[model samples]
Target: MKFRFAMVCSSNQNRSMEAHFLLKRQGFDVSSYGTGTHVKLPGPSIREPNVYDFGTPYKQMFDELRRKDPELYKRNGILPMLKRNLSVKLAPQRWQDNAGDGSFDVVFTFEEKVFDMVIEDLHNRYQVLMKTVLVINLEVKDNHEEAAVGAKLTLDLCQKIEAAESWEESIDDIIVGFEKQHRRKLMYSISFY
Candidate 1:
């Protein structure tokens, strides 16, 4: 059976969305979340981000940005990213707000800070269910190119995990080979609920 998976990031608009898009296309059981207090997107200036509440629809963001500056948003890849995100889910969800909804077998975070936040949130939830979830962090830069590459790498790792009879048993070896092949360091934590 396929494991329930989650992809999380600060904004859930780039790195997390990219991975979510890839995982969903593969027919994997997956969801994504943003850890930030508000969903933020790049604006005309670095200081002026287009911020929205966590539950705001991706379609709305796309429409707003398209209306504001279609050419600029398209050039920076924001328009395309939002379009893909809208196709994946209704909105950018906040991880904290999603706690009581359900649990994932594995949670993948694109950055260390996001990983830490997820781990902390899980820890604070307490172990009412006694089920274990593996949280893995693969540092991916928050850029279009990096997100695309990171999503592919995450997909490869998921394929390996899905093939194993017992993921807990083979995870170490799988990770070793993955790290060697990709030449990237991965950080992980185990949390229970």
Candidate 2:
């Protein structure tokens, strides 16, 4: 059977979206979500945050930000990122709510926090489904450039998982193998950069 995938991050605006785009492009049945109280992006100042809810229109937010603080929006690359995010049908969603549906075969989280959030939510709300899904945490930063780099890592891991699946390897084994490779790739990238 073809496996379904889900990518999750804190905001779902950068990291998860990048992986979602790459996996979808590669023909994986994948979705992306956030595990935050509310969707947040960098604002004009560190104290201020641009926040939105699930299903919020990207263009609408972009326009509002542009009108309110064009310089900040442009300087932070929010405009281009929003334009890129337009391809995503839905907005940021709390992972707890989304994961309850039990649709994904595998779930990849960009950080430990999100991974813990997914596990806690699943154990609390969908205990029966917890064992059915494989959740892996891959440490990644929540920035545009880091998102791109992390997307490449996600894509590589997915390809390796697919190959392992084709070889009739167990899900647990596939995850372990991919995770080891992912760590090596991350270390190599860090050292190179």
Best by lDDT: 1
**Model 2 / residue 168 / CA error / Å:** 8.9
Q: lDDT tens string, model 2, 1-193?
A: 5777888888746888889888888898888888877778888788988878876887788788889989878888888787777776545666766656777766888888777777777656635533466677778877889889888888877776666644234655655666676563221100000
In order of appearance, the predictions have TM-scores of 0.97, 0.84
What lDDT score goes with residue 1 in model 1? 57
lDDT of 2: 0.73
Give the per-residue lDDT of model 1 (tens digit) for 1-193: 5899999999747998899999999999999889999998899999999999999988888999999999999999999999999999999898899954446888999999999998998888857887889899999999999999999999999898899899888889989999999999999887887
Off by over 4 Å in 2: 128-131, 166-193
Q: What is the lDDT of candidate 1?
A: 0.90
- What 10-residue stretch in candidate 1 is worst by lDDT? 94-103
